[model samples]
Target: MLLNGLKVVEFASYIAAPGAAGILADWGAQVIKVERPGGDAMRHVFADAKSELSGNPTFEMDNRGKRSVVLDISKPRGREALARLAAKADVFLTNVRASSLKKSGLDEPTLRKANPRLIYAMVTGYGLEGTEAETPGFDVTAFWARAGVAMMTTPKGHDPFLLRTGVGDHTTSLATVSAILAAVYEREHTGVGRLVQTSLLATGVYTVGSDLAVQLRFGRLASNKPRTAPFDPVANFYRSADDRWFVVNPRGGAVDWPVLTKVAGRPELTEDERFRTSRSRKDNSALLVAELDAAFGAMAFDEIARRLNEADLAWAPAQTPAEVAADPQLRAAGALVEVDDGSGRAHLSPAAPAVFPGLDPGVLPPCPALGRDTRKVLEEAGFSAADIEAMYDEGAAA
Candidate 1:
């Protein structure tokens, strides 16, 4: 594996930081997840939801293949144990607030002072230096809402909706992973570690950067329109005869207009004055969309798919979760893999995003039970048996 022998000590909960660490673990890093006594709150994310079960795929996806060590960092002993872990770790990852980290003596200065070569990767809702640096933020609030993604994504005149779970966190996870790897490379030359920081808000802004860039440059942006009334009729979703929806993206404008019209069985319409040119189409996009909708609604999904293919029009079906799960392309690409639950049961889970050409990403191990590796991790950190016992007795270690 590319990151073989790399050691990461993760002090984070929920998705962002832990998700980044999970990717490092997939690439062959030994990751030790430092959890509170009751473990990450994500452990109970599905507790009150439908399909309640002892095992949670949500928690597993971000924590797989990592060892969990329970510690109450508010306690002096627990803070001491974490400091010891950071002293030996090649990388220290955390999503804990900057103020809390500083108060607990786990800030970058303290950790980097002990291990100058450590890569300190910090994930936050806002950032480390702002007034809201210590403000608690979740992906939905910071990433989606505060970052303008929610407003930008909501259709004009429609109420805002919640983002899908962990979408922003996972996106930020990719960013953090990239930053950590860069810092790791830099450390090889500088012989010193660096503080790499990323935030959900920042990641969200970047995710919607294309539109945001336009808004910034032009000082204005058109509100997001409904699919049926998009800025470009060629870039919209339409339903087939059987109610299967698919989107077309005629990005080449004039070149694709004819092809798209032909695919919709309306080649004659392309010659019409109101729809002949891109400008005219945009001016009357709603009417064009209505015409395409009627045409597509009269064709079966297979016929529409075949016609689109024949015309070389760019399009994709709006797949459901079930359809996505059965997609052959995803299966062949290793987008998902079977993971053991440690109790001998195996279930399919998402694989790391990147694939190394010559290395196996490795089978994902089960998410550890809370405090599962507390004793072992402490021992490996050079704590004596007596010391470990005393910490446990003091409720500092579990």
Candidate 2:
């Protein structure tokens, strides 16, 4: 609850920007999720299970634990209202395009002038001055496909594949939060705000650091399969008889090497020239893996699991989402939480992900429906009831 006193104003819609605000809210920031008069377009992204056209889990996921303010910032009065909110904010953020930011006067120069102590965080597909700046980009198009994600995920000659959800958007949002926190820390002493920016494309490229470095220096990178073996010999994922997967990287000082040797039942492997030293194992990784396959494949999953555990080698059965949801260790640690809404106790998926001193960061409320706090925020901002009504009449109350 250290963030209990932090104030955040968000001009965000989908997961990339609003999702970051949601995490801040979970840490106890008073995050105000701002949107257009009708609502964020993402509010209609996915219909609920009940009606194929009604519920939107997307909006619920990103805007949780925040107040909603409907102000049509495209309008002159709406822009003025939003600017007023920004002036008093500690952190202001948006995924809106650079052009939109300039048009609405929320660009760095304007916003910074309004609040010198405010941290301005911007999320976008491309950096502000790039040639691709004007093109619209989503997580899938900009981060996954155009970037090397499709290449990294699929084999050398296979068709490209997209991830099922917004991996890049969510990841970049967390990065943006870190940037904001750094700026906030600086502001505590200097009282000067700074602009922080991130892009899905850049983050995607940064993700493959080793590959990028290799390509940059050598002009190209060899695909995994083309280099002989894709698996890392003894350190990659392996499926057991029960379909449970286990991954381990046990070569270095594998004092537990005997455990693996015992599990392998190939006691001769210790003396085999191909498996003698770590360097030899890596060089002949493919051959060593074939030997392991022959050994482990002969045993039952339970037998092998028991042996691995007894051997004191690091190993675990593959767990699915359902299995992880019910994991005793995570539950005992209170990593998951159930919070109460006004109607019922709803299980909120995580926003803030770490624990401190055996305590959760904080509790997060469910996302507010659009405009749910318009009147209240207006009142807090000293807008008279008549003024609020007039603004609504003028199509400025989004």
Candidate 3:
């Protein structure tokens, strides 16, 4: 138990914030997630319609190994109870907006005064200051839409795809984790803690830092790697005769053109200067793509992949979510975990991405029912039974 003596209180939901807490849970931290009486909204997003316990797959994977307490902090006493928990916590993390923090009295200064050693982490939409700071945000709203990601990803004539899952949320979550770990490391020398923060928009911007720099430094959107810059005949996905897909990115230099031409049964193309070099091919990429497409159209995807593999060409079959779940490499690596799923049934899901040898890389707790750990958490906090009852009567706790 690496975190046997450490206690973490996470007042976050969805992807970005809870992701940091999930890391701690993986490392054996005694983490208690603070949710509202009805539970965090994420818990209900992907739940099976007929089974309440099904919860969101995103939440289940991110929140494993952490206990939950559904306490409303809307009232004075509720906030006071939360403060008490903070006083005992080694770390405090929240994804609520800055204004909301001030409103709830859970801001960093307030929590630091209660526990100087606390590693305070805050996650926001646009960051601590900006017009959008106080504005409401979601993963798509803050990360993909507002952060210039959509523009870069969208093909010229297509509606940009906002990722189906938590791309920015999970990315920013790793940022938060990196910050928290640094703060914890610094505590060893300073014997004090500091506030660490990250935002979905900020993280997305960082992910595309190189492109942003080019645009800012040169006053031009990138035209060197423009989408119209024809796809390399050898370095692209192709649909086979059977309508199955395979990506083949063999060596892209002129020297490697012979390898692909041989596969296409058109060795004469290697001698044609129009398709000889990469630069010339770029001038006629459509022709090259059409030629390769025709060649692939004559074979099954599996057969194409095999021939390309034997020819030392890099190739792989396009896989779906179901195929990904059963990937042989992933299974051998124990990256997917099996859970009872609280339905007298079992389901396998992806586990945390990294692992430490000799440590239990397992889920310590499953997603909880609303208020599932309310009584237990209160008792642990030294609240008497009558006092707890009084709190319920006052509508401060659930």
Candidate 4:
């Protein structure tokens, strides 16, 4: 409830921008989500030719605890309503392409003229100024592919793979949220709002910043190798006798090398000339990995875990999604939450990332049905009941 009085008017669909607004909503902002008549396409992501699905967790994750208003912005009436909402809102968030926004008179200049205190936040694919400024882009295309994240992450010889769903969008969402908060803070002193912007491409570049820094400095970079052929044998994954895969990353330097060898019951390997130093181990990583693989393959995960812990080495099991869901650590850290659906049913969902020490963001409300708050929002925006009805009748509002 930290943002209890904050009002965010969100004119975005899909993940990144909406996700930033969703976090604001979770923190008790009154978020009004504007959608087209058909609703956000995310609402039907799980649909098939046979039947539309009953539940959409993907949409719910980024849209819960917000009000939905369907508006056909192409219509003057709907655009006027949105402008009215912006005049009163503390923040206006959108991912709509620049050209369309300008054509509809919903651009930053127009909105800010009516409300100088409005924090206009925009999320884009490339950026606000570029040849592809208006290009349609998803996180996969903009963040993963065009930003070089996919290229650097994929194994050298294997075909590039897709990122897990919402990975890049959620990252960009966090960035957008941070920028919005910074602008909000500045507005307090200046009494003027500013245009805050983030893009999937920029966020992706920052995500791999360390690697990109190396590429910039060296003018070249090493490709990601397969797990079995990593650059660091000490920081590699192996399977145990029980077939549980786990990764180990000992501390930097050669201090833990001999300790690892002894822990694997291959103490004699500590003196092996080929594996004596860090450089030697990396140069002969394949051979060292094969040796460790054989040793780990002979032990159950429990034994391996015990030995690794006793040796003070850093390691963790490579668990599946199901395992992660049941992980006690996730709950202990408050990463998981139960949201109250309208029917009073509590369904598990991920909590917003940050945790304020003293304030508790209470139980989150369910995602609103499409156009659920259209009439209410319009009435609050000062439209008469007759005007609201006319808009609905004319298909300007739903």
Model 4, span 1-398: residue lDDT tens: 78989999999999999999998998889999999989998998887636554678889989999999999998999999999999999999999998899999999999999999999999999998978988887899999999999999998999999988899999999999999999999999999999999999999999999999999999999989888878998899999999999999989998898889987889988889988888888899899999999999999999999999999899999999999999999977889778877788988898888888787656679999999999999999999999999899889999
Candidate 1, which segments miss by more than 4 Å at Cα? 50-54
Point to the candidate with the largest lDDT.
4
User: lDDT tens string, model 3, 1-398?
Assistant: 66576788999887888888887777678888988777787887865477656356777778876888867789887888788888898889998877777888988898888799999888888888866678777779888888888887775556777677888888898888888889988998999988988888889888877888888898877432322334455577778999987776776466567888887667888878788878788788777787777887898877776777778877778889877877888856768766557655667777657766676554345666667787789889888899788778987788
2 or 3: which has the higher lDDT?
Answer: 3
Better of 2 and 3 by TM-score: 3
TM-score of each: 0.97, 0.89, 0.90, 0.97
- Quote the lDDT for 103 in model 1: 96
lDDT of 4 at 196: 95
lDDT (10s digit) by residue, model 2, range 141-190: 88887777778767677677777676888887887888899989999899
> At residue 353, what lDDT does model 4 achieve?
87
Comparing 1 with 2 on lDDT, the higher-scoring candidate is 1
Models, CA RMSD each: 1.3, 2.9, 2.8, 1.4
**Candidate order, lDDT descending:** 4, 1, 3, 2
CA deviation > 4 Å runs, candidate 4: 49-53
Total clashing pairs for each candidate: 0, 3, 0, 0
Over 4 Å off in model 3, which ranges?
1-4, 46-55, 223-231, 250-256, 263-265, 343-346, 357-364
